[model samples]
Target chain A: MISFQHNRREFLKSSIGLAGLTLPTFLKARAESVGSRIPHKAKSCIIVYTWGGMSHYESFDPKPEAPADIRGPFGNIPTKTPGIRFCEYLPKLAHHSEQLAIVRSVHHKHGGHQQGMYINLTGKDPVGGIKAKSRKNWPSITSMISRFHNPTVGTPAAIRMPYSMYDNGTMMAGEGAGWLGSKYDPILLRTPAGKPYAGVNRYNDRELKLERNIEKRRVTDRLGLLDQLDNSLSHTINGSTPYERLDHYGQMAADMLLGSPVRRAYELEQEDPRIREMYGDHIGGQTLLLSRRLVEAGVPVVQALCSASDLAGGSGDNWDTHRDHFPKMKNRLLPVFDKSVSALLTDLEMRGMLEETLVVFLTDFGRTPKVNNNGGRDHHPGVYSLAFAGGGIQGGLTYGSSDRKGVEPGSEACSPADIHATVYNAMGIDHHTELYDQQGRPFQICDGEPLPII
Target chain B: MVGTFNVMEKLYYIFAIVLINSVHPLQAEPEALRDIERLNGIALKLPEGGWEVGFQLRGQKLNDEDMEAVVRLGSIVSLNLRDTQITSAGLAHLKKLSMLRRLHLERTKVDDAGIGHLTNLQKLEYLNLYGTKVSDEALEHLGQLHRLRKLYLWQTLVTQKGVNKLKNINPKLDISLGIDLTTIVVTNQKSEAKKKTEDLPQLEWLPEEGAKRPPDRSYTGSFIMVYFENNRSKPVKLYWINYNGEQTYYANIDAGQRREQTSYSRAVWLVTDLQEKRLGYFVTDQNTSRAKIPLE
Candidate 1:
C-alpha cells in the first residue's frame, strides 16, 4: 500500500516538474536532452569592451593591398599564423596569433556611439530613448550570462571594473541588468592600482571603491546599523521586496569588505611585481589583471572597459581617434593594449586558467576606411573586427573578411547577435532559451545562431 | 471491469515513476557532495559527462578528508586542488577519477608520492605541479601519462635532466619551466635606472604677456608624461585647460620642485600665482617632456 502511494506521488511530481523548472534544473534537463550538442568549456567569461570604435585597418584587418588613403601609414606584419597579419603597431599581439580567432566582418547599422555600444553590449537593437537604468532595456551580455551562473555564497555573479561607460558626460545605456532587474546587474568595482587614464572618472554611491582603504571595524559598524534597520523593517516587508533586495546588497557588500576572497584579490600589492609589470603600469592593464583575479575568486563574468571611462569628444586615451590617429595608435594606445593583452594571455596560459576562461573583445564599431583630412577615421558601421580566445575557441583562425577596400563585409558576414550566441554556446547556454521580464512577459534571449568559431 | 481499470492505473503510475527516475537519476550521495561544497569546493556538472571540481577559491581550510567525499560522487573530469591543505595521502582517492583530464595540484604539500598515483590517469591532458616539492622521481611517474600535453614544473625540485627525459618520451608536450625570481628584480632595477637617465624633450613655454594666447581650450590626444619644474622664486599653481576651455587646477608646485604629471598630448597647462593670477603656459606633445617655469 505504501509503495503504491509513493508511485502516485512520483507521477504527480514528474507532471509538475516541467512547469516548476528553476534555472539550474532547467539547464540540467536541457544538457541531458541535448546530450553533447553544446560544449560547456567556459567556466568564466571576461568581456573586454573597447568603448570607442577601434580601427579594423589598424588592428586586425590591415588592408595592405588597399590604396594608401584607405590603408593609412602603418604597414602590416606577419603573425605567428603564416597567413594572418596585424598592424605594425600591434607586434606583441601579432605573436599571440595562435590563441586569437579574429572575426573581421562584424557589421551593424548603428553608427552613433550610444546605439553602436548598445547593440554591441546587449545584442539587441535600441528603441527610442534608452536610458542606462531603465528596466525595459535588454540586459547586457555580462548580466545575461551571469543570470545563468550560480556563484558561491558572497561571490558576485558578474562584475565590471574601472568605471562605467560615458560619452560627453552622459552615461551610456545597456551596461546594467535591464529587464533582468538589479539583482543580476554586474557589480561595478574600481581598479585600485596603476596609472590613471587621462580623462574624467565619475563615481556614484553605488560603485564599490575598494581603494578607499576602509577598515574591517568600520564595515562591522555599518553592518550593525544595517542589522538595526533590518530589525525595524523585517516586519513591514512581506517577501522579496525592494527593501529586502537592498538589504541583501548590504549584506553582500559587508561580506566582500570583511573577509571575502574578492577583497583579498583587490589587494594588488600582494601580487608579484613582475606580473604587474608584465600587464603594464596602466589603468587598462590593471583592470584586466583584476578581472583575472575576480575570475579566480569565482566571479562568473567580468566586463572590463579597456579605455577611459568617458569619451569626452575624442580628447583622452580612448579609441575614438578623431584626429592624430596614427601617432596616438603608435605611441600611446597600441603599446599598452598590445603588451597588456598579450601578458594576460600568457599569464592565464601559464596558470592553466585559459582553457576554462573565455576572453572576448568588443567595440563600438569600426573606423572608416579612408583617413580624413585631420588624419583620423570616423565611425564606420559598415564592418568591424572582434576576437575570442581560450575557452575552447579554436585559435589562429580568421572567421570572416571585409572587402579589399575595407568598406564593408565581403564574405561570411555576421552580426553582434551572432557573437553573443557564440559566447552563449561556449558558456553552455541555449541561446534560444526564453527569459521573463518583471511583468512576466517572455522574451527570447538571443535571435541569432552561434558562429562556428567555437 | 473496475478491477481491470485499477490495475491499468497502477501500471501507468509505475511506468511514469520509472521514466522520471531514469531522466533525473538522483545524485548518488547528495549529502557527500554538499559536504565537499561546504568546504568551499565547487562541483560543476559538465554538459558532456563527469564533473569539473575546483577548490582553488577559498579552499584553504579543505583537508585530505574532503578528498574522500569528493571521490564518492565519481566521474570528476577536472580537479583543481590548488592551495589546499591536502597532502600526498589525499591524492590516493583521485585514482578513482580515471576520466580526469586536468589536475591542478600547484602550491600544495603534495610531493612525489602524491604524483605516483597520477600515473594511472592515462587520459590526463594537463598537470600543474608548480611550487611543489616533487623531484625527478615524480617526473618518472608522470612519463607514463602519455596523454599529458601540458606540464608546469615551475619552482619545483625537478632538474633539467628530468624535464629532458620526459621530453624525450613525449616530444609534443609543452613544459613551462618558469624563470627564476631573482632575475625579475634585477630587470626591474635596470629598467628604473634607464628611465631616470633618459632625457625628456623640452616644451617651449609662452609668457602670459607675450605670444598669441594659447588656444581657448585643450584638445584630446594620446597619453604622455610631463615633468614640470617650478624654477620661479614664488610657488606656482598648475592648471590644465580642459576640453571645455575651463582651467582645472591640478597641482601646487613649490619653488625649485618638480612634479611628474600625466597628461594627453596637445593639452595646455597654465602656471599661476597662489592668488589665481595667470603667469605662463606650456603645451604638451606626443613624447615625455619637461615644462620648466621661467626664472624671469
Candidate 2:
C-alpha cells in the first residue's frame, strides 16, 4: 500500500511539471498566429521628428477656406492627387504626394514641450516627475522597435544622429530605453559633416572622431580614452551605477571603429556629389542622407530630428515659429525640408529600397487655429497632422481629417498611440505583445488599435 | 506498483515529445529549407498557408543550387532574390513557384530568357526587373502575366514601346520606366551655373584694425558657398571662429588661388598671416558670393 501511494504521488508531480512546460508552448503558438497575420514589410524605419510643433496648416492640411487668422499667410497648391492640396511653401513635397499617406486628425492633450515630446516619442502619457534616462519610464518607440530587429553583429541596434532634443537647455525625456534597461537605449551619434543648427546644442562631446590620420597603434589608446571618458560621463549624467558596465555600447563602439560596414557608411565624402547636392548642403539634408546610409548599413531604426537641437525660445532654425511664422516657414524651414524629403523618396525608389524602408514624420501637437499677438501660432493640442510613406503603406491616401476651421478632429479621430500601433503593425510587431522589464514585470507595449491605412 | 510507475514514466516521455514537436513545427520542415535559412535567407511562413522567401541580405553566395532548395519548399507566395548571385540559368528553377504573388529580380542577371519562365505564374501581382539586362523581349514575356499590377523596368533595355505594349495587354498595369540619370545631372549643372550668375548678397570684409570688427564666434545659419580669392602677396591661413569663440584652422589659401569654401550664413571667417597675425575677416550671408582679401 505504501509503495502504491508513493508511485501515485510521483505520477501527479511529473504530470504537473509537464503541464507547466507545455502551457508556454501553447501560448507561443497562439501569439505567433496573431503575429503572422500582419505581413512584415518594413525591414528598417527612419523617423523624421520635427522637434517643435510643426504646423499642420502649413505642411499637409492647408485650409484655404478658413479665415485669414486661421489659414495664416500661406496659400494652398494642388498636389499630384486630384483633391489633395499642400501649403504653397511645400511645392517639392507636393509632387511626391502619391507616395505619402497624410494623417491630419492626430491629437493629444499635452501642451508643454516635454510632455508633448514624451507622448509623441514613447506613446505614453507622463506619469510623474519623469527625468531623462530614468528606469521607471517607458521605452522609446525607436528602442522598442529595434529590440525586435537582429542586425549584423557590430552595428548599433538603433542610432539617433546630430543631437538630442532639448528645450532651452533641459534635455527631454522619452528619448531613452526606460524599463527595457540600458542595452536597448538608442546610441547618439553626431552628424560628422553638415552646417550646425543655430542654438545651444548640449551633449556634443560624446562623438568618436575616427579620422583617417589616426595610426593603427594609437587606435587602441584612443578607444581606452573613450572608455574612460564614457564611464565618467555616464556616472555624472545617469547619477547611478554605470550602465555601460552592464551594456555593450562601449564594446560595440570599438567594434564599429575597428572596421565595419557602419564605419564605411560614415564616409559621406565617397557619395556622388550630385546626389549630395540634390539633398541640399544644409545639415537637415545631410542628416537625411546619413539616415539612408545607416539604414543600408543595417541599422534597424534611425531618428533624425529635423529641427535645431534646442528650442531656445524659437529664435533659430526650428519649427517652433512662435514669431515671424511666415518668414521662417517660407525661408529657412520649408525649402530644406521639401527638397531633402522629396530627394529621399526619389532616391529610395530608384534603388528599390523604399519597398523595405519605412519613413515616418512625427512632431509635437499642431499650432493653434488663431494667429497669436506675436504674429505666430501657439500650441494647439486639439488637432494636428503626421505622415507615413513606403514600407507597403498605401500612398496618396489621407487617413483622417480636421474640421473646416482646422481646430479639431472632424472625422476618424486618432491619437499618437494609434499611429504607433500602425507603425508596429507595418513592422510586424504585434501591438498587444507584452515585454517584461528588468524586474520581470510584464507591460503591454501599446494600447491602441492600428489604423486601416495599411 | 513498480511496474505501473515505469509505464507512467514512458507515457510522460511520449507526451513531452509531442508537446515539444507541436511547439517547434519548423523542426519537421525539409532540410533544404533549413539550409537556405542557414544562409541568412528568410523563409517565413505566411498565415494563409504559404512561405515568403527572401535572399536580399547576405545573398552573394546564393546560386542555382540554392534556387532548387527554395523550390523544394513548394508553396512560396513571395520571393525576393534582389542583388543575389542567381543567373538566367538559375531562374529555370523558379518555374515551380507558380503560387508566387510578388517577385523581386532587381539588380540580378536575369534577362529575357529567365523572365520567360514567369509567364505561367498567373497569380503574380508585383514584378521588379530594374537594373537587369531585360529588354523589350522580356516585356513580351511579362505581358502574358495578366494579373501583374506593378512592373518596374528602370535602367533596363526596355523602351516606351515595350511598356505601351504591356499596358495594352493589361490597361490596369502600373509601369515605371523611371527618369534618365544623365539628364538629371546635366540639368542640375545648368541650373547650378544659372544660380551662380544670379544676384547675390556681397559680404563686407572687416579689417582687423577697423572700427567694425567681425563677431568673435560663429552663429548657426543657412548653408551657403563662398568663393575666397587670395589677392594678398603671401599665402594666408584661414581659420573659422568656432561656436566657442576659439580659432579652428580650416585651410591655407596661396596667393592668387581661388578656393571655394562651403560655409553657413552668419559664420565668421578670419584670415591671418603664416605667423597667425589676424589681417582681415569676412562674415558670410545667405547667398553664394565672393570674398576677396585686398592687398595692404
Recovered fraction of real interface contacts per model: 0.13, 0.07
DockQ of each two-chain model: 0.18, 0.13
**Model 2 misplacement above 4 A:** A1-37, A152-155, A203-261, A372-374, B1-28, B186-198, B201-296
Q: What is the DockQ of candidate 1?
A: 0.18
Off by over 4 Å in 1: A1-37, A211-254, B1-28, B38-40, B159-161, B178-198, B201-293
The digit string of per-residue lDDT tens for model 2 on B245-290 reads: 8886767899988666656678899999999999999998877778
- Span of ten consecutive residues with least summed lDDT in model 1 chain A: A15-24
lDDT per residue for candidate 1 within A242-295, as digits (tens), equals 433543354354345445778788888888888887787888888889888888
Number of the top DockQ candidate: 1
So what's the TM-score on candidate 1? 0.81
Query: What C-alpha RMSD separates each model from the true structure?
Result: 8.9, 11.6
Q: Say which candidate scores most in TM-score.
A: 1
The local distance difference test score of each candidate is 0.80, 0.77
